[model samples]
Target: MKKYLIPLLAISLIWGCKKEVKKADESKEIMTTEDEGWTYLFDGKSFDGWHTYLQDTISSQWQIEDGVMFYKPDPDKNQGMNNLITDKTYKNYELSLDWKISVDGNSGVFYGVLEDKKFVVPYMTAPEIQIRDYTNIPDFTDKQQMSGAIFGIVGIEKDVANKAGEWNHFLIRIDHDKNQGSVILNDQEVAKFPVNGEAWEALVENSKFKDWEGFGITQNGHIGLQDHAHGVWFRNIKIKEL
Candidate 1:
């Protein structure tokens, strides 16, 4: 009886040790630090941390469908109809997303947006990376208005936007410490401009955003998307703090 009991205890101890080892191995796989600095603002699943620019709730025009944040047109809505904004504020960071527009569609990705209800247009408070279907949108006169442009402030010399209905990638980096901002489209550097430098001041002075106090101020604010009264889809929205 003693001999049998001794063997059973040894077997149990060995099994316990094996289980512990297995747990350790599993934890190594599950606990990863790959996304430590990156925060997934959108995972193509839900609009959990986003809302309209100044409103607490999301607008009916903005919809999450087929794993994309899309804007559906509504003729009755006002100028600021289709804007959506991030719930949290970010100071300096790198943001990335992909966008595709319908025929003749127009949209924009904006940053440094101040959440003031008094600001009628989102562009007044934030600088934008323009997105539009250049080929189909006849009124899209400026190459800077094509895609990856800093909207009215800066322009891309060449067209980098994919054809309408196809996805185009955008990467925007803002460094508040250096007061610099840069944009990349399809892995190519399209625009690089200083935030508070003479060039930026000139841009602000000439543009309609001049009068706004918070215009082009990159201290800390929410990211925004323009509605533009057309169908547009955005996905894979992610950001990393710098």
Candidate 2:
């Protein structure tokens, strides 16, 4: 009886160790393949590497609800500059996300954001991908001010933005090596412009951001979302450096 018990215990221990080893191996394999170069800015659960621009912590205007990055503003507490930004900056990368804006709302996805104390808003130092509800937002009347535009630098050639309140996709690519960048909305290529050189300089010179000192000057900076004091949801946020 003692011999049989010892054998069974040994078998159980060996089986347990084998299972643990298998799990570790599986985890390593998945990590290597699935998430090797892709960085999830929003991890679908928490705001791990995100914070308000120039601030150490996230503001009340931004919240992670369920698995989505939600913007729920307080009219009474609204300072109008509580934009959310990434902790780390990237030089050249592919950024993708899904966003839905409230009717008549306004927002933006900004990159190359220089969070300087001299600037009160991210747009002052960063180029923006305008996020607006085209259904009712009347303040911006230019095609360059609509969704997926290089916000004022160039207009979106294609009108691919979905109606407000419906989730829309955005894929923004920056390749400084080729001196080209693109904006794709709803899987359709809508805008392409020279990211550098004389063409880029001319566009900047004529746009609203022309007077801004640091706007589009740096190649690497944080990515951020404009808190336009309205309801907007952003999720499935991720980036892959190019």
Candidate 3:
């Protein structure tokens, strides 16, 4: 009986060691993937890498509270074009962020945003990912204009957005190498379209951006956030260059 007990104890010790080793390996793998070419656009402390479109500074309406970057509208002040954009430019990359809108609020995320004086607004040059609380918008049946749509250029494949005031995640990938741009909303692939060439041209031609000369013409540009006079919150903004 003593001999059998000794063998059983030894076996238990070996099994424990093996389990510990497996856990350590899994933790290492997770760290490696998170650090692999990914960068945080917002550090949750301040708006260090962002500024207003066409302006050199950030607007007072855009506030950083706790860890969220949000728009706080001033009823007394006349807010004119307070759109925020990144300081640096990105050509082909994967962008990830979380956003929440007020009840019946509207906003958007833009890419390929040109800051030239000729373009008065970011939408003039960039393509927008429409963001809105469609569930709260009465009688708004236009899926092309809803959240996760490519703003009138392309509609989303599904509507999986959370209700107003609830958080929704977006993983947007723009790959010029593959000539494809995609939007993954709440881990669901909602939209996909061409970023350049004839297919892109056709998409633009059929959309409202057909007359805008700089719209989606350049694959490299700044990313922008719309200030559509509605309350919106953003956080966990990061990017990975592909």
Candidate 4:
């Protein structure tokens, strides 16, 4: 009876080990399925797929710490307005990211950014979605310039961003195939506009970009993070190409 008891215990232990392995494999399979068709723009370790606009290397101001891409402001650096941009160009995709800004700080996410020797900055050709400390900035009254607005081109329906220091999530979908562009802030639809065609032109024409040639013209371009000389952090940046 004792010998049989020992064998039964050993058999039970073997079954438990098998169950554990099965659970692990099932978790991995679920994770893989969830991640399918999505590409991470920032790997959370280093800036491998990004660089400074018009430059081959990223500036010292950009740092990867605590799994976040942080813009460490250094007033004495005198680096000018050098933005970080994706090395590859994307035409139609859904981009998701998280951002946080310091008090009274301002920055922007630019899409369809054309990088050229003639163009000094990305804003010359890209359409920006404003990222600012809206709740804290006393003078920021314009809805068109508020966080999640297509900066000056299109305004948000409502302010859905968290306060200055809190993390806000932005899910931007730019699909020229459907001729529609939209911004989802903090899981709410904040802004939507035409991606191209006459309506897009009219929006740009009424804005300050009216005189800026090639502004929002190209369908394929790079995504950019503006350097407004304020402390900003970005994380969980990923994209799904359509």
lDDT of each: 0.83, 0.86, 0.91, 0.90
On lDDT, the candidate that comes out on top is 3
Across 71-159, the per-residue lDDT of candidate 3 in tens digits comes to 98898765648999999999999999999999888899998888999988898899999998866557887888888999999997678
Q: How do the predictions measure up, each by TM-score?
A: 0.81, 0.83, 0.87, 0.95
Window of ten residues with lowest summed lDDT in model 2: 133-142
Evaluated against the true structure, the overall lDDT of model 2 is: 0.86
Alpha-carbon deviation at 188 in model 4, angstroms: 0.4
Better of 1 and 2 by TM-score: 2
Q: Name every residue pair that clashes in candidate 4.
A: none
- Model 3 residue pairs with clashes: none
> What order do you get sorting by lDDT, best first?
3, 4, 2, 1
The digit string of per-residue lDDT tens for model 2 on 1-242 reads: 99899999999999999999999999999988976787889888888888888788777778787789889988788656789888898888999999999987889999888888988889788888988886654454688978899888899766777888899999999877788789899989888988777888999999877887878877778899988888999998989998
Per-residue lDDT of candidate 1, residues 128-168 (tens digit): 88887866556666766778888887888777678989998
Residue 66 in model 4: shift from native, Å? 1.8
